[model samples]
Target: MSSPDPAARPGHAPPLRVLILEDSRFDAELLTETLDRTYAAIETTIVQDEQAFVQALAHDRFDVILSDFELPGFSGGQALELARKAVPSVPFIFVSGVIGEDNAVELLKRGATDYVSKGRLARLPLVLERALKEAADRRTLGIAEHRLRDAHAAADRIESRRMALIELSDHIRDMDDPAAMAYMAAQMLGRQLGVDRAGYGVVDTVAETIVIERDWNAPGVHSLAGVMRFRDYGSYIEDLKHGVTVAFADAREDPRTHATAAALEAIRARAVVNMPMTEQGGLVGLLYLNHGEVRPWPSDELEFVRDVGDRLRSAIARREAQIALTAFAASLERQVEARAAELEAAKEQLRQSQKLEAVGQLTGGLAHDFNNLLAAISGSLELMRRRGPLARPGDLERYIGVAQGATQRAAALTHRLLAFSRRQTLEPRHLDLNELIHGMEDLIRRTVGPEITLDVHAAPGLWSAHVDAGQFENSLLNLCINARDAMPGGGRLVIETANLSLDAQAARAADLSPGAYVSICVRDSGVGMSEEVAQRAFDPFFTTKPLGMGTGLGLSMIYGFAKQSGGRVGIRSKVGEGTTVTIELPRSEMPAEAQATQPQGLEPAPRAPAGETVLVVDDEAALRMLIVEVMQELGYATLEAGNGAEALRWLHSGRQIDLLITDVGLPGGMNGRQVADAARTGRPQLKVLFITGYAESVVLGQGSFDRDMHVMTKPFEMHALARRVKDLIDGP
Candidate 1:
């Protein structure tokens, strides 16, 4: 393999640079010498370790990587991985001793070009030659892909341009005035075809008379603007008569041309291509392309000229017909403008509706969470106060006061969110709409501001609605405030009340019931909404008002409350005109609840009874321990279990347990609810208090528990759990 070829053909190839990675110095040196002797152009670089192999690759580019499968510190796979990362496109091939077929396949999958056995030094050159050819093929494929993308982009551009031209042609055909259409057509030609001059010329075929009617050119070409004679040219007329394309590479040099030397000089003509226009066999006119410098016309350019000539001829023929169509187009334009205005109004309405809807969803979710927290806090506080001052003495009254305050505030917040979500527990009663508005008149006036004029238009015999008094009052107030903000420069705000009875079809269409309802409409002469705003009007937390000024929750909560109460909400707005928000609440048949003359807060009366040995079970040590303390202070001996299995184990061992108190979420095989269920089965007399952190966890949902099973959410203070336990043990 090292000997020179006897049939060697000299100077048949360029020098091939080979990167050789081998651990053994002796074998690398031998292969280098052998390659130098065998091939006239072969430069070899040898690196043993993976680091040296990688460094060589970074410093210089290589055609192929040749490495051994095994080395002292690094293997072929490691070198191959490093080489691929450095130069992803470069090919790699392994040369190792006794590598199995499976090992070779693995190397190939990892992007090695090919593998050659160690003793086959003679095949090394052949291997390198084939690898380089494959690399070249890959490079060729990559270039072809790039060219394909460019070609596709160009084709798309051409298609788009053609569509634009078609639209322009359609617009021209719809015009009535010949002179106007001709002027517009000349402008179109100058812009689309990059022409210096565009004109309409009248031609008489038999008489060979070509008259320029109207010309579009430089500012002071009035002499050439009028009709001109072309009868002197016989061959030019013949070319037009035959529909032949006439070309003059150089007018002075073309033997078939008919212009005099003076005329040619005045025109400054170099290259000219003229396409004839014909309707049937007779010639109509000619379209001309004149270049300042001498140039050959491309076939596509001539085809374009022919197309333009045909359009010009058809335009001239329909000149009178176009004039009659202008009135119809004008009417269409007016209709379109009116429709656009209507669409704009509709869009603004939609935006306001969507904003209200978003707010409703947000308020509903927030109220759900807020309610749980309130429940825990309130229950815990009630439980703590019943235990008296015996357990924590001096601190007992202070803790009770703080817990009660927090519970009240929490309830207030949830009440607001629920009002927004339209799911608040309602104590609905028949209410006089006129009287309610009259009562809220002062508040509404203040809300709308000094700049805005408040107008109340209550209809006679206005039906009353079944609504929560506080929420109804708040909703009206929110609408008035929003109206005030919208009319910063001052506008008229109108509040009116009326009756509405939606039919079955209207009910389904509006996603409401077919029933009578009372409406409170609030209209403001503020900046009206666009269509986009109207769609999102009811979306929770969606507001156009600057951040701090609006919660974006008011309208949404109102919308939810309306729907949940078997009624609906509506909005109307125009850009310059203002917005109207109307809220409808269901009518009630029951007599109205009399308004209380005064309101009072609850004061702590007396300590309640705490009896029976209650079992408090929880996985959290702090919570379980807190419950135990609360129960013990309440004069009840408490039994505890961390999870279900532990509780079950205690029951199985015959431990006396009165009531089971378990955490809903547990680490063992069973959850708190399941544990409670199992414990109740073993101990038939067991009462349970299920404590949980998540509202939608194991202890919640439609079928998760029996109606009577007591449940409480976590993050609760010691008192809430104790009161709930006492209540279950002592009864309502």
Candidate 2:
């Protein structure tokens, strides 16, 4: 096909530079000769591998590209993408025997100019003719559009400064109200700049929020007023906070605003200038000019905006100061009226007797309800006090047991209160839901009792979660018990665990993060809660259970635990239908650990290696003394420190310390985790145990610990602490 169109199409077309990407030598010659038939003069460059093709694209210029759709070590679409990114004005045509119509259509959609199969080499010339002409046409149109934009920008810049200076000279100084001043400034700027929307928003720097109060809008443009976070628009808010004027020609083209391009376009702010107004070196106001269409923003236009924004801010500040003085005078008038109102209030004192009758009625009902708890405690103690003198050992034991049960109930009430308030400590660790449910199933069935049938569904590939295991079990037990009460006559109860994933939209709807999660759903077939009851189910002290039966803090405490663990819980129910309670915990990204099983009971604390010394740090002296004594009893040499400073002192003393056990909360500005990290820098093999009452969420949330470091929540049994320390040091 090569070398013969010289006389056939003589002097009809200009010199066309074509880049061909094909592996077969014969096919490349055939394609080049075919293109030669269409044009009078042509120059062609051929390359096969990606490296040669990329180098050619970088160093050479070409008018058109011809590529094989299916090539060795390359792809037609990949070539098209590279061509579009590098020299987008060039026409990219695919000419290959293996090209399918569907594949050709997809390549066309992705910016390939056209495709021709080798079986139809005669048609390749015509395809090249159309592609080259279209590319030339696009170039012509782009030049015209760019020239128009420049002309418009020039006109806008010339008129911007003179008109803005005229408007800002005096008009704003006459306004008395801040709102009026804000509207006047907006209108003057909007008309002079010919923008879609111009507005003045009061800034609350401490809150990082702005309230527009009002704005001047062009015809058909919607108003944007009310409170909004500065970050909702773009990261340019950071620049504004630093007293910088931010102007961008296009939201999608500017790096500072591109990430929020869709949001800006939605609000008709494709081009914008946000000017900051400062008072005493702190930002307190903003003047914004926005446009629905993308356009160039000149430096002179931005400077004009800054000048007007300052004048508007000064006028508003003066009005606000005058208003504050007026308000002070008005407050004196209010105080005089308050004194007269007090005299009138004295007349109402005689009506107190009448009001007391109604108050007594309400108090009586509350007292009657409170007596239920008081009776249980008082009756148990009264029996103990009266029978103490002549009681046998067995009788005394029974009476004391009764009194202890009453007080235990009271303690449970307080514990639930702390849990709901998120004041109770939690120790979260990586755990698998399937394994956790397998161990807790039997207990769940027993709690629901014989009448109810329990069903457990564990998804085969349930994800691992980070949560407090004991709190999770307690929450599950509470739900199961609540389900049992709902189904007094017995029904089906289902417990399920499954992996969950949420995208941006779904996560926003669920009020959760967009990522992998583990969900536990407890469903029951019984008389269900009404919408009214379900709404208040998580409210503390609001329960459907009769007095003295349920504390109502159960669900609230579960809610608190879910939130504190960076998870969320939701309940769904309808009258006469079943209820489903769902808890979604974020999947742990920490490296997988062996599935943790329920402890079968405590083993003897493993003794440390010979001559191993333990460094104990705590702010509480009594607790520190107790721990040191325990370590000594466990047959380990112990060194003690009352705070983190003293602990670090011992750590840096070149003394031999086999293990470090410190409280998470410590004085002298060094927490237990920080001390461990610092010590490990010098002694990498130092084993650590963090004892804490508060969650120390920020410290542990890092999820950086190795097998040598462990944590134990406060109020843990001394045996548990001893075992943890021994495990870290001895590595069992």
Candidate 3:
């Protein structure tokens, strides 16, 4: 068999060279002829021995190595090992005559590409072709591996630049000062790009200049923090104005940088990059990076610098906006404070106006009421004076009664005013709310008239309340009358009593101590009030009635009574919805006491004890003498004093006194209570009667008194005084 020829081919054909280690000239010739005929072109080299084989391999390149398994000087295994040492990528195949199966397998195992028997020379060509194809595939794979490694290196560079840009962005966001942010951005960009210096410049179009606002330079490098005219770097500025980045490995060689070449050389800058920063379609500034040595700025590095410029621009804008917002907020706060002061002044003026209006209303009401009373008293006194001594006993008594009635009415009016003011003396007692409401059912029905329906709902487990029974009855009656007036067409009135427990939170809102309370609700289906009217419903003389219709003291008196009794009053009303007034009084744990029982039938006034002496102490001489005369007519001996000091002297004089009638308000820094307290040291059993016109001292004392003491308001009847005196002298 002949060896294949190894030669070069035309038209994109790969070159092939064969190394032949065969002793037989016929076999080598046969292989060469077979390859020359089958392939377009190939080259072949024949080496007869081991020495020739080594020499031929050292001097020439080969695609495949074919050898005889056994030769004159060596075996095919030796040739395979030698070929591996010389050219490890070359394919080595064995072709031999009379070779054993085991030997062929052994040859292939020891680095031989394949083995072909000389008897099967036809298979030699196919085996050789496969070996050569395999060798080509290995070369292609090596080339692919080298390219893969290069791509990985490039990817790593890109990732590093991306990481640096991300870190820069994070740093810029937290910088508040625009100038400081620019300096910091320049420093980071210089460090990241390994440049000698970096800076930012603001563009002045009108001035045709570029001002270096901030800059960062490496050690021993000059800073670029100065202004430069656009004319000095005309070509560079022109390129930047068109939004093109100007970069150069050699500033002296770049035509566009010629105008600024002298300045670049002065700074020892060999390479530079200028990236434009634009805002609102206008060039705002430029970011520059300079190198001491010439550098070809890579595409990736340029991209990173551009991103840094973008971040710097955004940070500057944010800082300016923040500064403006802070200034605006400060100005707004000052304006708010000024407006608040003006509103406060206006509110003060409105309060003064309301106060004057209230005073006028009170004065007008007082004048109207007192004038009528005075007229009645004056007319009665004139009639008596004109009829003097000639008047019939009945007529004389009638005239006197007329004057007395007017006086009593005036006194009642004064008492009501005091009550509404919360200055009246109160006699608090523990009483059941259910019982009080039930007892007043008859009076409430009469007051509301037959046309109105009245409902009394008393809770089963009613709690006792501590309050003045008489005052409560009066307040209830007033409410009923007001309800009747409101409902001219006759609606329903509901009075309910319930036990309530007020917690701390609820009690605070009502201005009361947190504890159990008894609630009394009076609901009326009448003409309801609006929010404004309801707010002022408890103001004295603030009446919604027509002139001469109401005194407007009903709700005011009720409010005062509730407060003085350590309770609270609440009113709920809305126009066209009706009204509900609720009174909550502190609950008493003590058992309720029976109300003072009145005699069913009128009994004759008891006469004073015979020879019983009484002391009369008053600040007014006329009042003292009148009291003395009344006692003397009752057939009792009387002693008189004009003041508490004088009364104490009389008591200390060892006078026998059955009762002491003293005015509560006295002069000389001594009150009736102190005098009475002192007189009691001498006569502990003396019965005391206190009289007052306004009862300021008594009200301050909470109206508390012992069983032997009694209080009477001024303008009382002579008959009432006489009856009280007789009762004090009599046994209880």
Candidate 4:
């Protein structure tokens, strides 16, 4: 190392301070003079002994040290050691005559900066300059190394703090309980920051207090859980609210903590770090760290505390939201349950109202229809009575016929009412719908009239349905008649039959069991019904027909019959378009039998079997007498009873009764079917005939009858009655 040339300086610089370690004043002055000869400025301190040198080194700063190799007591090596201890960064050079190369090399190795021999007195200035330059370079290097160590230490502190914050974040994230998370955060922060106590506080602006939610204290440290109130800390809280960290090395002496000093002293806190926690730009609380000894909080530690505050705030907010959401869900569930119960109650009320409404409609329509029949009967009977003796044979016969026709119409209407009420008995029989529809083609066309075109489309191999054949045919006729009335002019009427296989989905939607079905659809192009009218089409007595023009039980009867026969009915209609009514009946697994086609016209009264005895029972004496006379006229012996008890008496008496004829609705507490069942105990094959104005469904369950049994509605012609009796007597 060599000093820069003094000649290269632009101006005079500060003097170089030098220390001369020598016992001889002459040598020291000589050394100084040698340096002054080349240098512009110099300042020197000369010491003679180790004591003098030690004092100068301790009290003064120097650039370089020069010493002699040998002295009266101390050697240059000892001087070098003393200089090394006092000013380690300063250069030490030996300028002694007694010092040889070996000793000089040893001295340099022993921490002397350099050695200049007395024999080379002219080289002293150059050597001294070099020593001074080297000393300056060494001082710069030492400062840089010290700073580097400090930087490494600071970086390590940052990394450790960052890792602690990350661990705290993870712990908070994994915890669901707000209280637990708060306590855990406090504990982790206390350990990370090496504080005696750490705690979380929640702000209560309204109360002007900060509630200490959770706290963790190290061993032998007091907890701060009960400490609260911003007023206790005077205006210090205002600073925290404005996002300033409140820190103090000594709480007892800090002006900002004067109001809270007593409280701090109680907790044995010498220093404190109070970091504000904020949410949505408003101060929510504070994160507090308390130290039992005075501690100067570094900027990094303050920043870390702030970060923990943020994490705790977020965790608390999230936990609160979760609790609120759970409560809301429970409330919603309760509300839904209450609403559903209300809906069910409302639905039941609606159903009851609809039932009452249907009953009213039924009674009104029935009254209207019966009144019309009664009017016709009453008029015809009045006419007969008026024309009694003077009336021509033709006039008398016509009036009687009119009365009979009216009575028959009234009976038919009653039967339809029973059917619509779903109380009608259905005698289910395996029948092919396609064959049945085809057979009724001519009859349907005639019923619709010549104005309407009839199209019968029966699917081949149509499935068989189990339904009462007579009731089904009557239902079909009622549908056709309705179609005819719908169309004032002319329209195409299509009768279609199809085999359907309903899958699970379709069956569930239709409220039917999944299986095969047979459908009979009656479609017509006529003035269609609107949605409202169509919806009530199946309601008894609900009709769009003009008053007195319809009984309004036409569609209703069909709907009931289909349902009673284990089936459902669907109707599709649009205003000004057309209507298609479909009856879907479960497919019968039994093979369909070929139906016997009878002559359209009624046959002449058939004769009863010879020696056949008939028992006729009726509550109405006239009807009973009439049946007895008809049976006797057909060459059968006849007995008569007004009630079931009388007939049962004859049956129990073991009388030779060939056939039992009884009214279905008897007054003596026993109906026709019960008497028949009673008589069958004695004669299991006994022949019985149920004649009634009451629907057969009432007397005979499902309208089903065994062989040798028959049912005939009241108001039937004499020929029909005789024919039924004859058929029963002569079994197929």
Q: Find the 10 residues in a row with the least total lDDT in model 2.
A: 361-370
lDDT digits (tens) for residues 1-732 of candidate 4: 123455655688766878888888888878887877777767788888888888888888887888898998888888888777778888888888888878877887899878887768798788877877787787789899999789767766776776777788888887888768888888988888788998888876657688785689999986667647777655577787776778898877898787678777677676988888777877787788888888899877877777777788888898887788678667756766878755665566568668877777778878888888888987887677556669999999999888888898887787777777666545568998788888888888778889999988889988788888889999899888888888989999999889988999999887788999999898989999999999999987787887768777888889888877778899999988889999999999999988977757977799965868999988887788888898889999988887888888888887788788888888778888888888899998888888876455657665567767777766788988988888888775
lDDT, candidate 2, 1-732, per-residue tens: 233455665657646788889999988988877776666677788998889899999998888888888777678888889889999899898888888778888888998888888888998878888887898889889998899788666755655655666666576777677887788878887887789999999888778899988999999999999998878888887888888888888999999889999999888999998899999998888999999899777766676777777778877877887687579557646765777655554455447645766456434533554465456766665566556557677877876676656556555554565576676566677887788778888888888888999999999967788887888888888888889999999999999988899999999999998999899999999899899999978876668898778767789888888887788889999888989999999998875456555467877766766857999999888899999988998888999997778988999999999999989888777888888888898889888888876556555754456657777766566777787777677775
Model 2 segments beyond 4 Å from truth?
Answer: 1-430, 588-592, 609-611, 701-703
lDDT of 4 at 329: 64
- Candidate 2, residue 538: how far the Cα is off, in Å: 1.8
Error of 4 at 377 (Å): 0.9
Pairs that collide, model 4: none
What TM-score would candidate 2 get against the native? Answer: 0.45
What order do candidates take by TM-score, descending? Answer: 3, 4, 2, 1
Q: Please give the distance, in angstroms, between residue 129's alpha carbon in candidate 3 and its true position after superposition.
A: 99
Per-residue alpha-carbon lDDT of model 1 for 1-732, expressed as tens digits? 123343474755645677889978877876777578667766678888867887899897777778889899788888888888898777788888867899999989989999988788788878877888899999999999899778666555454445645765787787766655556655565455554455555568766776665655534323245554453322455776777878776666665554542354355335666667676687776665544455676564555556666676677676743454456557656766877755665566468668767656676656655666666675555456445436475566666666667676565555555555554544455788788889889978776778899889998887767775766787788889888888999999999988888899977887777888888899989898999999888876678987456556678778867775567889999999999998888887765556654324432322335346666667777767877776776677767777777777776777666667777778766887777777767776677776654433356543245644766654454655555665676663
- What total of clashing residue pairs does each candidate reach? 48, 0, 11, 0
Model 2's alpha-carbon lDDT is: 0.81
lDDT of 2 at 136: 80
